[model samples]
Target: MSTTLILLILCSVMLSSIAQIVLKTGMSNPGVLNAVQSGVAMQMITTISTNLYVIGGLTLYFASAAVWLLVLARVDVSFAYPFVGLGFVVTMLLAFFINGEVLSTAKVIGTLCIALGVAIMAQG
Candidate 1:
């Protein structure tokens, strides 16, 4: 891939990672689901609306969509799809670190396999 394409892919991956983090933060709020369950969907909506992290996450999600569109304009779908694997790797790491989620040996091996597959595809 050309440098421009590589940069675009990196930006998309980073933006996607940031979006996940922000969404996680928004979800971390203790009363988030309770507000929804209490028939306070509007209040939940308002809460998310005022939350900088959630708003930033939403913005980054849209921005990533736009960037991905631009990337598709310049690259083949085959190439672009592999780039999404980077997002998967990032999300897995974030889940482990940010959410205190456990990564079993089996899961680690699976993720390594995915990374290897993506790497092979990128090399090809």
Candidate 2:
């Protein structure tokens, strides 16, 4: 891959990871669910509309999609898709550190595997 493609892949993965983190932070506020079993979808919408983190995260997702489209035009989907796996690794570590979420042995192993898989595909 060229330098530009590599950069795009990195940007795509980083944006995705950051978006996931921000969304999780926004959703951490339990009240955001408002009315679940009651089946009032609009309440959920209202909550999301009002949450800055959620709004920002969703916006980042759109931005990522736009860049990802450019990336798709430039490279094979199979080659590019594996790069997204890095998002999982990024998210896992962020969650563990930022949220104080658990980082079990299994999770560590799984994340390492994702990194390995992406590297394997990148070699091809």
Candidate 3:
């Protein structure tokens, strides 16, 4: 693949990963957590819908999808889709650093496997 294609795919994947973190941050807010724990659907909807982080995350996700469309137009889905798995690695790292989430041994192993698979697939 061309350098532009590679960068575009990576950009989409990173944006998606960052969006998940942003959404998680929004949801982890105490008020959002309380709304969720309350089990009132309307409260949950209201809290989430009005959250700036959630809105920004969705916007980022939309941007990622737009970039992904460009990727799809240029390459085979089979060739491009595996790259999405890279988001797992990206998300894990972001979670670990940004959210202070634990990075278990299993997660490390799984992410390594995914990275290896993407590398192998890219060679085809």
Candidate 4:
């Protein structure tokens, strides 16, 4: 792959990963969703609309989708889709460190398998 293609794919993955982290962070605030439970869905919408992190995350998600579309146009979907697995790895690591989530043995093995699968697919 060309350096440009590599960068584009990286951007898509990183943007997606970052978006997940940002959304998670935004939702971490207390009462972020309590309004829904209280039957006041409008409050939930208001909270989401006012949350900068959530808004930023959504923007990044759209950016990722744009790059992902370019990637799809340049390569076979089957060949490129495995790369999406990289996002899973990125998200899991971020979740472990940023969210203080446990890094279970199964998760590590699963992520490794995803990497291996991507590599195997790319080699074909």
Best by lDDT: 3
After TM-score superposition, what is the CA distance of residue 20 in candidate 1 from its true location, in Å?
A: 0.6
What TM-scores do the predictions have?
A: 0.85, 0.91, 0.97, 0.91
The candidate, 3 or 4, that scores higher on lDDT is: 3
Tens digits of lDDT, candidate 3, 1-124: 7999999999999999999999999999999999999999999999989999999999999999999999999999999999999999999999999999999999999999999999999998
The TM-score that candidate 2 achieves is 0.91
Per-residue lDDT, model 3, residue 1, is 79
lDDT of each: 0.83, 0.88, 0.97, 0.87
Model 1 bad stretches (over 4 Å): none
Worst ten in a row by lDDT for model 4:
30-39
By summed lDDT, which 10 consecutive residues of candidate 2 come out lowest?
30-39
lDDT of 1 by residue, 1-124 (tens): 7999889987888789879988888867766656656677789887768777788889999999889888989989897788788787788898889888789898888888888888898886
Give per-model CA RMSD.
1.8, 1.5, 0.7, 1.4
Global Cα lDDT for candidate 4: 0.87
lDDT measured at residue 19 in model 3 versus the true structure, 0 to 100: 100
Each model's number of backbone clashes?
Answer: 0, 0, 0, 0
